[model samples]
Target: MKDIEQYLRQNKPETPDEGQFIIETNARLSNVEGIKGTVDAERHRGRLMLVIALVAGLVIGCLFTLFVVFFPVPSIETELSAFSKAIVSLKEWEALLLVPVAACAIALGVFLMNRKKEVL
Candidate 1:
């Protein structure tokens, strides 16, 4: 590399601005290519992250929907009508109770699965 630099300096044409122009053009080209490569790498990384996040969200959404459909929490209604009095009543805090219970259930399942796999 040093030898190449020395040869270029010694054998470069005698035109006044030509060597300066060549050096500047090479510097600009280097900067442009570097910036383009950096941007492309960043774009690829962002796309991968977006795909992973989307997949995670979809899995969580599916699980939540299944939970709601299968393990329905009871609801309490105070409205009284001749047609409604026959319906059974449930406690008001049933939904709230299920929320924490489901959360703990999922956490426990995850913890047990990880433990079985020798993961923290």
Candidate 2:
């Protein structure tokens, strides 16, 4: 073991010149920085798109709710058709149904936003 160690020490490997080593290191660092910037930009774009979509959904939902409340269907049961009855039932339970759906959507969005991404 001592002989082998002595031989290895005596035959130490040669390193590249300082200038070439520095150039290669700088090239590698620049590549890494480019990748970092790209990843950051993509994350920013994704978050912006998510916010826009959320705002659009909320605006449309509020507008639809307003339209429903402002132009309610007539509640005359004497000549109620199947479609009209269905519409009435939907209108009556709209809040109950929409509340859970909206809650789930918000929860999903929050979970997605808070979750960590795994890299392969």
Candidate 3:
């Protein structure tokens, strides 16, 4: 264990603000009440932008997935139609119905989540 630790210490990539980084990054973050404080406002703005970007990317990804599933592109329509027909033809009635039911369930779930947030 000691040897492994020493190897890691010697070979690890050094970061800027090494000691401060070690202390701040390793410390348990806690909200200290009654300490009205201000630091670099730009950091908070950058954090907000990062969050927005992540959320936007997630939303766009989901939208793209749904769009592909629901709206087949013209180039792929023949292939998609054949696949869709195969599914309907091969599966039992109950099994074939599951696709639409699953889509409805997902829509309902998203709707309910949005409704709850609106109420809150």
Once fitted onto the true fold, the runs of candidate 2 whose alpha carbons sit more than 4 angstroms away are 77-86, 89-120
List model 1 lDDT by residue over 1-120, tens digit each: 999999999998975758688889999999999988977766665555556555655665566555544544334234564234322222323454465556556655654554444321
Tens digit per residue, CA lDDT, model 3, 84-114: 7435433424444455556555655655554
Candidate 3 segments exceeding 4 Å error: 1-39, 74-120
Highest lDDT among the candidates is held by which one? 2
TM-score of each candidate structure, all chains considered together: 0.43, 0.54, 0.31
Candidate number of the best TM-score? 2
> Compared with the true structure, what per-residue lDDT tens digits does model 2 show for residues 12-96?
9997569778888999999999989977876776676567657766775676666655655666555787678557856776875
How many residue pairs clash in model 3? 0
Ten contiguous residues minimizing lDDT sum, candidate 1? 84-93
Better of 1 and 3 by lDDT: 1
- Assess each prediction's global lDDT (C-alpha) against the native: 0.57, 0.68, 0.52
Angstrom error of the Cα, residue 82, model 2: value is 16
